[model samples]
Target chain A: MIMDDYKFLFKVVLVGNAGVGKTCLVRRFTQGLFPPGQGATIGVDFMIKTVDVGSEKVKLQIWDTAGQERFRSITQSYYRSAHALILVYDISCQPTFDCLPDWLREIEEYASSKVLRVLVGNKIDREDREIPTVVGEEFAERHNMYFLETSAKESDNVERLFMQIAEDLMKQARSRDLPRYDSNTTTIDGKTSTISDFSCCSK
Target chain B: MHFEIMDYELPTNFDVVVVGTGIIESIISAAASRIGKTVLHVDSNNFYGGLSSSFNLESFLKLNIEKRKSICMEHSSLNDTETFFPINNSDFTLDEVTHQWNITNKNKNYSDEENSAQEDIIAKEICAKKWLKDDLLKESRKFNIDLTPKVQYARGDFIELLISSNIARYSEYRSITRVLTWFNNTLEVVPCSRSDIFANNKISIIEKRILMKFFTSLDDNEDLIIKDYASKTYKCFLTDKKLSKNLIHYILYAISNSTDSTLCLEGIGNTKKFLKSLGRFGKTPFLYSMFGSGDLPQEFCRLSAVFGSVFALDQPIHGLILEENSFKSILIGKQKIKAKNFVLGLNLTPDFFLNKVKKKFISRGVFITNKSIMDSDNEPLTLLLYPAENDKNPCTVLELPWLSSCCPKDTYLVHISCNQINNPEDDLKHCVKNLFTLNEDFKAFKPLIFYSSYFSIPTNSDENVNLHDFNNLFICPGPDSELDFVTAVSKAKELFLKMYPDDEFLPRAPDPEEIKWDGDEEPSDIAQ
Candidate 1:
C-alpha cells in the first residue's frame, strides 16, 4: 500500500458567524482564488493542502463550516480530533466581531483543551471596517490565541496564517507534543501492528 | 457593545422537513439533500442525535434530572379543516435511569516502598492509574457515554452505505480487537479468524477440525442441505451434524450470535455474515466508531449539511398540522414552516399514527470499569455475547478501551444490552454480575465498576404499523435490540424510497479535492 508522503497531518477547522468570509479565507488559501458571491458552500467537505515545514512536508486538512454556523448547529463531532481552530470574523461587520465571545464559548466547550486557536479578522480590504486591528489584537491577547488580519478578497495574510499554523503543528509533532496518530494500528496480545497486512478471505 | 438579537427566522419553505436527528432521519436527510432537495433537519434536543446522542458524564447526569420533570401536553386550537397534533419532545424513550460512583473522592495512599513499586510499574507499562472519584469528575468531558451503543460489521449494510455515500471520510473507527464469550462460568476468547482457529488451545484438535469443516461447508451453496434444515432449529442442525457439545456451544452462542431457537437458515446466514466480514479490517468482524456511536449520525448530518441541508438543533416544534388526513406543515414557536414531505422519528409521531404498534424495550447498562473484563497486555476493544441462561435473554457486551475514545485514560466503558424482561438493572444484572465486580473486594481479577448507569430504551418491534393515512408523512423507528445497525440503515433506505421513488439514494459525494472551485482555470488537484 502506498502512503501519502507527509511527515504530519493536522486537521484545522474553521468556525465563526456565517457570511464572515470563513469560506473565502479557505478558498483563497487552498484554491488560490477568491470566489465572488460564493453562495452557500455545496458539495465541498474539506480541503487538503500539503506544505513544506523546514525539510518535511506537512499536510493540513482544512474543514469548512458548511453553513452550519448560520444556525449554530455545528455538530460537536466537528470539533473532535481537530488540531487547530481558526475563528474568523468580518472586520467591517460589528455583529460578526461581537459574536466572537459566543464563538469562543463554543470553542471552550467543544474543542480539545490542547487545540491551537487562531483569531483571524477577515475582510480587511473593506472600507467601512468597524473593528480596528488593535481591538482584534487585544481580544486575541485576552483569549491567548494567535492573532492575524487577512483580506481574502485581496489574498493578503491568508497564506501566512495557514503556514504559521502548519509550522507550529509540525514543530509540535517533531517534539512529540501532540498525540501520536494511531488510526491504522490494531493491537493484538499487546503487540501493535498495521492493518494493511491483513485482508479478508486470504485463506 | 450593544446587545442585539440576530435574526433567527428560518426560511418558511423546504422540500423535506425531518423532525429528528436519529440515524434513520439523518440518513434520509442526507439522501434527500444529495439529490438537490432542500431539506430542514431539526431536533428538539440541543444535541445532534435525539435518542442516539452520546453525552459526557456531567450532561448525562443533568439529562436524567431533567427527564424526571413532567410537562403537561398543551392544547392548540385548529381550524375546521385542520387537525393539530402536539409534538412530544420529552425523553419518553429513556426510563428508570440510575447512575452511581463506586469510588470515593480521596486518592489511595501508598507507603514509600509501595510508591516506588507503583512508579516502576507505571514506567514499565501503560497501566491504569488508581483513579479517584474527583479525577473522574474533573475529567468528565473526556468520556463519550453513548445512549444507544452499536458496532458495525466490516462488510455490513451500514459500512457499505458509508463507503458508497462517501460519508466515511468524516468519521474514524477502531476495529474491535477481540470477540469473547462467557462459557461454563469462564470467559474465553472466541476464535473468529483462520489464524485464531489454528492458534486455539482450549478446544481439542478434533473439535477444531470439525469447526473448520462446518465453516468451510458454508462457503458452498449446499442447497439440498439448507433445504433439509430449513424447518428445523439451528441447535438441532448442529446436533444432526454430530459435532461435540463444546463446538455446538461455540457455533451457536459465539459465532452465530443467536439463541437456541434460531432457525437453521437464519443461523447460517448470521454465520456467513460473520465469516464474510473477517479480516476486512482486522481479525474481528466488528468496527466501532471513534468517540461513540452517536458520532455516526452526526457524520451523516455533516454530509447533509455539505449538500446544502439546513440544520437547527434545540429548535422545538410546537405542533403538526394535518389537513384532511394529509400532512400540511409544522408550527415552530410562532412560525409555521411548510414542507412538501415530512419524516418524523417514532417518538415524535402522534399516538394516532402509531396505534396498535407494540413497543419493545431494550435494557441497557453503561459501566466505567477500572480494567478490562478479560485482561490482556494491551487494551483491547472487546465484544462478548453472553448466551441466554435460564429465563434471561442473550445479552451483548461491548467493552471499549480509552483508545477507542469512548472513555478517559485508565478506564474502560462497558455497555451491556439485552431484551427488557423487567427494568434495565434487573434484566442485565445476571450478566453484569458474572462479568464485573460491583464491589471492590469480591472478584480479585474482575474489573471494578467505578460509575454505572442503567436505563431502558423503547423501540417499536412490530413492522406492520398502519401508516397509510398520510402519504407524505413517514415515521422512522428508534434503535432496536440488535448488535449492528443493519436494520437502521435499511429503515432509512426504505423511508427514502417511500418518499422519493424516482430520486436516487445517497450517491458517492465528491471528495474535497474533487470539488472544482469556480474561477479556477486549471483543474483543482490535491496536494497529497
Candidate 2:
C-alpha cells in the first residue's frame, strides 16, 4: 500500500477502565458495526480507518488496550509514541468516572506533554447515568482536554468524535507543529541525511 | 482515587506459560503466540523486563539500596502425586552495586567564564559549569538507565528476526555513528569503511594502502586461506600477514570484535559479518534502540500481547507443580494455572533444578556525565571496544547522548560491560579512569561523572545440559557478555522449534490495513 495516499496519518490510542466501552466505540467508528458481546479484545492489535477532513484523506490508527487495563498493567511503551490519547469512561458507572484522575496521572507521566488528549464519556445510552454531561465537561476543561459523549450501542457521536480528532491533527500538521511523521532522515550538524539505504521490508 | 487491585480472573489453562520477561523468554512467547498458541507471559517484577528492565534515576538508586525479601510458599496444598518447586525471588542478581555523585548540590554559573576563556575551547564549548546533583534529580524521570545495555548489528540475526516477524514497528532506533578504540592511551576512531579509511588523516599513505589491500583480500572468497588458519589464533594470522600494529589493533578489536585468542576462522567470520553490515543503516554497523536496550524485550512482549498472549506483571508465582518429572501447573496467589509446557528464565529456576549448572558473571558500570567521551559538534552515539591490557578483560563501552532518548539533554549515559574477573569496580575502574574523571579538579577534556554506579549480574554458563532431563521444561539463560542479541535470538528459535516442530516461528504479522474482519466488504474506501 502506498503511504502517500493519505494526507496525514495519526496514531490515536484508546485507554480507560476495562468495561468502559472503549472497544465498542472503536469498532463502531472503524468497522461501522458495534460488536455484540465483545469480550476482552483478543488477537486484534489495532484498527485503521480513513476519514475525510476538508477534501483530504486522513488515516487513523486506533490502538486498543487489549484488556491490559483490567489490572492497570498497561505497558509504558504504549503511551510514548502516541499522537493522541482518547480517555474514555462509562457514564453509567461512577467508579469508571472516578478513575479518571488515575488515568490522567499516567498520561502525565508517560505521554508527551504536547500530545492531544480528548475526554470521552461512553455508554451514554444507559438510563442509570451516574455522571452528567456537565460533570465530564468540567473535568475536561480542568484537564485541558476536548470533551465528547458517545454511545456505541446507538452509534451516537462516534464518527464525530474521531472526525474531530483527525481534523485537529491535520490542522496541526499543516502548521508544522505536529511531530514529524516516521521519516528515517535525521539532521546531523546542520545537515539532513537519510540514515537507512534500505526500507523496513528490505532484507 | 486510590489505586485498587481489581478481581481480574485469568484463564486456568494455556498451551504454553512463560515465567520471566527477559529477551529470550519474550521472544519465545511472541513466537508461540504468533503461531496460534495460548500463551500467558508473566513476570514477578512490576516491569516488563525482569532482569533486563530499565529504570529512571530514582527507581534505579532505590533498587540498589533496598534489600528484597523472599516470598514463602506453602506445599501442604499439593497432593501425593504432585511435587512443588518453589521460586526463590529474594536473591538479587546484581552484586556490589556502588553509586555516588561527584558534583555538589549547587549549580555553577558559567556566564563569566564563557567570555574570558576563548582559547580553552573544549571546556568553554561544553559549558565549564558543573550541574548540581539536585538538577539531575529534578530531571530524574528523563533518565532510562539500563541494567543491561546492548547494540545490534544492522545485518545480524536479531535485526533479521525483528524485520521478518514485523515486530520492528513497536520501537525506533538510532545508528551508532562512530566506533572508537583505545590505542596509545588515547581515544581514536576505528575506520571500518572505505570512505572512513580515506577520510582519516592519522594513518600514513603506506599504512592506508596496506589496510585497503588487506580488507580487499578478505572481500574475495578465499576459503582455502581461511581454513588453513582455522585451528590457529587470530593474532598469529595477523602477525603472519605482516600488518602494522595500528592496523592489527583496528582489525582485531573493532572490526572482528574478538579477543587475541579467538580462532582465526571465527575472527574472519566476524570481520566478514561486520563488513557486510556496514552502510545498511549508517556509518557504523550498529543500531541502538531509541530509549535503551531494555526497550527491546517490551517490544517483543507487545507483539506477544497483540497476538493474544496474556501478560501479567507484578504477579508472583508461588510454586510449580511437577507430576512424574513433567511440568503440570503453577500456583499464583490461590490461583492454579495449568499449561502443556513451561519456559522460565534462568533466575526463576528452582535451586534444585540448577544445582548442576555453573553460574557465570558479567561486570558492569553505569555513569552519567556532563559531556561526551569524544567531543564532536553534534551529539553522536558511540561504541568503544577497549581491548584487554594489564590482565584486564576486554571492555565494551557505549556512550549515549540525549538524542537517543536514553538520558537528559546536555548529558550522556555511559555503560561499560565486561566479563567478570573480580568485582565490578575493580574490573572497570581502569577503563573508567581513562575515559572519565571523578575528581572535582578534573582535566578539561575528560568528561566529569556526576553520578556513577558499578554492579555485577550473574548469568548462566552454557553448561545447562542437565536441565534437559525434564521433558517439557525449558530454561532460558539471562543476557550474556555479547554486544548483540544473536545468541538470545537463536536460543529462542531453538526452544520454539522444540516445542512446536510443525509451526513456523514468528511468521510476519500483517499490518493493520491488511487485516480483514469477518464480514467486511471491499476494503473501506476513503473517498466515500
RMSD values for the candidates in order, in angstroms, are: 4.3, 4.3
Best by DockQ: 1
Kindly report the docking quality category of candidate 2: acceptable
Q: How high is the CA lDDT of each candidate model?
A: 0.82, 0.82
- Which 10 residues in a row give candidate 2 chain B its minimum summed lDDT? B519-528
Give TM-score values for chain A, per-prediction.
Answer: 0.87, 0.86
What TM-score results for chain B when candidate 2 is compared with the true chain B? 0.93
State TM-scores per candidate: 0.92, 0.92
Runs of candidate 2 with Cα error greater than 4 angstroms are A1-3, A36-42, A174-176, A179-203, B1-5, B65-67, B109-125, B128-130, B219-222, B356-358, B441-443, B520-528
Candidate 2: interface RMSD in Å? 7.6
Task: In model 2, state the lDDT of residue B457.
Answer: 83
Proportion of the native interface contacts kept in model 1: 0.33
Instruction: Give lDDT: candidate 2, residue B277.
Output: 75
lDDT (0-100) at residue B302 of candidate 2? Answer: 82
| lDDT (Cα, tens digit) per residue for candidate 2, span A1-203 | 24368877799999998788888888888876655334324567788888889999998999988767776768778886788999999888888888899999888776777789999998888888889999999999999999999998788899999999998999888887775433552212212233443221222
